[model samples]
Target: MTVAAISWSAANARRMERQFLLNPAKPGQAGPGEVVDAMLAAHAQVMSAAELSVGLRMDGATRLDVRDALWGEEPSLVKTYGPRGTIHFLPVSELPMWTGALSAVPGGPSPFKAGDRLTPSQTDEIVGAIGEALDGACLTIDELSDEVVARTGPWAGDLVLPAFQGMWPRWRSVMHVAGHRGVLCFAPNRGRKVTYTRPSAAGSEEPPLSAEVAAGRLVRRFLYAYGPATSPEFAKWAAAPARWAGEVFASLASAGEIEAVEMEGVPSSWVVAGDTEFPAEPVRGVRLLPYFDAYVIASHPRERLFPGRAYERALAGGQAGNFPVLLVDGIVAGVWHQRRSGRRITVTVEPLGSLNAGQERELEGQAERVGEVLEGWAELVVGPVAVGAHA
Candidate 1:
């Protein structure tokens, strides 16, 4: 059977516009819950970056709006450790699905085979202890660790490990582990210390969605947002074992939930069965996407999005989010950085090639939008379009 095809241009436009990156922010246009639900979750390692991520999509959204949606009373959003075990801002009501899907993911064995590390059983105990400790209240990691020790014996706190910041206690590692159980999520910051809380409207009972069920839904959700991908791509995105991702893909393909399509030069492309409608209008306008933007990460097959020399300059060590990028139409055309001085946000765009009058105009407008989101004036500085400087 000949699989249907989705062009690079079409796919880019549909996802950019649908993901709301091509539009202006309209404050309160969509409820806080709806904004995140559309993208599944926003990359939120840095709270400010996450705020900018949401602001670009909505109309005139202020930082406080993002905060209210998150760490607010009657919040419409929830903070949780999502795909790849990275912190993300998830829609509040979707905790069950996120938890169910993530919980099923095999974390694999501890990297260190032996030593002062958490045994499998001990790790699980920490997860359970976290849920119980934070059942209806917020607690700092240190505060919660004490309760975990009380619940699971001293083994829960004895395991100390090295991390990006420094040595991470067993209690700290399990924070995301507890997140997978759907009972625990991050609470608002209390002064300088981070805290954990139970998700609003979350039940203490067992997760309603099973691992198998959640895995299938996760596949569909990924394809719905970034489709025409292979099983391996899904695995990379979810941080799941390859064998498991293949099983999920097979199950979905058998159920007719997704179908295969032959992309131009690529093989084994599949999209949601009925989500093949291409954008009626081609994507226009320029966009200055921040580091770790969802659009940059969601797309599969780096070569298509970054193209030839564009990839090297935009990515560092083949990793995304190392540098902010310039997007003309739908492909990465250059790299840019911003510096804020008082009320002025000066954006320096270093393109890979010369731009026409129209692209320059659109880029300035895009820069202005960024300034608006930051509540500052925008100044555009177009430097020479150069690449391969390191080479």
Candidate 2:
């Protein structure tokens, strides 16, 4: 049997509307928690950026709304290290499943392989120490380090290595390790320092899903949220090993959860079977997305989103965080940056191509929505930004 191909336009439209980045059906009805659940997780290395990300998707959402979901009592959101071992805001309800699947991804090459440092047994010792150190109370990295030394011996602290953040100890990867062990997690900020806490380890009432089952669920979530994707795309997005992702996709295809579909000019893509409904209206208007927005990262064949000059200007070192993106018609058209002084916020937009009157009008609206999320008066200044310029 022949599988149906999904056009770029149809796939882009469906993804945009469903993710609430475009043509939101209900305004103000969905809160921060629901918005995040829809998108699986929000990139949160920069806390304010993730807040803006959530605010853009929900009707009348504010920084406080996202904050409440994150830090409030009976919290609906949880922050953790995920997807490249960077911070993300995830729904608290799905913590179990996310931990199960994300922990399965293999870590990067370690210097220990050359027997320089971090022997395999020592690595396990540090991971165990981190869980014991946190023991329910939130502790800063410094405090955790001391506790780890207490448990694993002082030599653990001596295992320092060069890091972007000054000199970091070898056990820094233990955060990813602890996360995989389903023990340690990020705690709400205590004063100026980041803290961590461990969850209760009482075994789940139901038997935990095997690694295969967990990986299957993660792959399904990726395609459901960002479908028409290739295994390589899914692997990159999930931070899973290529061979592992290939095997998961094979299993999923055999189970009929997804089907291979040819995208025009694009070699291979897969989408959830029977998910073919197109959007009522075509993708129109403009949007100023935050740095590392899921819309910017999850989409595949980025050449389509960042074509021509956009490929060079909007991306740096083949990464997206260099600047927030300007989206027009469900594709990246430019780059933008925002600066605030007191009550006034200034936005600088650098479009890759010219925009006509209607599109320019949409840009104005985009600025307004951006300001609403910021809770400040926002002004848009369009044109090329000078090299090494500030907004």
Candidate 3:
């Protein structure tokens, strides 16, 4: 079959629109849960950023609204470990799919040596213990560690896996795996401490799909949201083994579940079967994206997405999401920073080039919107941002 080609700008517009970043839904038109569903998952390691990532997409949403969706009666979202083994807010209804697909990822060699690591059987035992521990309850990590240690053996609590300033328990290593298997998820913070609970407690009742089936579905969804991408890019995004991702993409292509594409200046790419259309016009707008925002993290071909000065100023060593970005027409055009003092927030944006009067007004509006999502009054400052990643 002859491969179809797409210009990078059009592809960027399609991806941004699909993620609701190009033209976000209006106030009250979309909810936080809906935003999470559209983005697949909202990166949540930095909870505040994740809240903005979701809230910014839903024009009227506030951080509290996002909190409610995760912790309110009949919660609609689940906080768990997701792609790249990072914290994310995934839709509750899709927990089963997430578990199946994540658990199926082929893990690499342990970062720990033999003595510090849990044996395969020990790992399974610990995972089972975690599910049993968190059933019908939410426990702090220390409290859960006690329960996990008691239910299993002391070896489960052995402090060997090195962490910042100290070693973590053997069981801590499998926390992400347990999260993948639907046995664990985040609960509301207990004061200053984090807590964990089960997916069942979060209103997820469906059993997981088979690994093969779940993986196929996940791949299709990835293509839909971030497609016209190569297997290597998917592998990097998912943190899966390159060989495994290649095999999966090849299988999908052979099964007619995805089709090949020839992107300008790129060797090969694939999109969901029959998903070959692009937006009629390239995306045009000024927007503020929080750190680790899913759209910035998942989009491929960094050179095209970041472009020119953004490649150096916005990105940290070619890694997206380490710094909050100022985007112009779906491309990173500057870097931004935010500071909150009492009920007011100061949003400082440094665009690579001078904005016209119209763009300046739009930027002020965007800054105010960021403050609104954070539930604070915002003051915009157009100046130099002299800080490093995540500063």
Alpha-carbon TM-score of each model against the true structure: 0.91, 0.91, 0.98
* lDDT (tens digit, per residue) of candidate 3 on 295-389: 98989899889888889998888899999998887888999999999989999999999788877888999999999989999999999997789
Per-residue lDDT tens digits for candidate 1, residues 117-226, read 67678778788887788888889978888888899887666657777787766666667777777767888889999988877533234343888887888788888877
Clashes of 1: 6
Q: Give the winner by lDDT.
A: 3
Q: List the residue pairs that clash in candidate 3.
A: none
Cα error, residue 209 of model 1, in Å, equals 1.5
Q: Which stretches of candidate 1 lie over 4 Å from their true place?
A: 24-29, 164-166, 201-208, 384-391
Residue pairs in collision within model 1: 25-58, 25-59, 25-60, 26-58, 26-59, 27-59
Q: Report the backbone clash tally of model 2.
A: 1
The whole-model lDDT of each prediction reads 0.77, 0.76, 0.89
Better of 1 and 3 by TM-score: 3
List the candidate numbers ranked by TM-score, top first: 3, 1, 2
Off by over 4 Å in 2: 25-28, 111-116, 199-208, 265-267, 387-391
Error of 2 at 73 (Å): 0.8
Which 10-residue span in candidate 3 carries the lowest summed lDDT? Answer: 22-31
How many angstroms is residue 95 displaced in model 2 relative to the true structure, after the best TM-score fit? 1.3
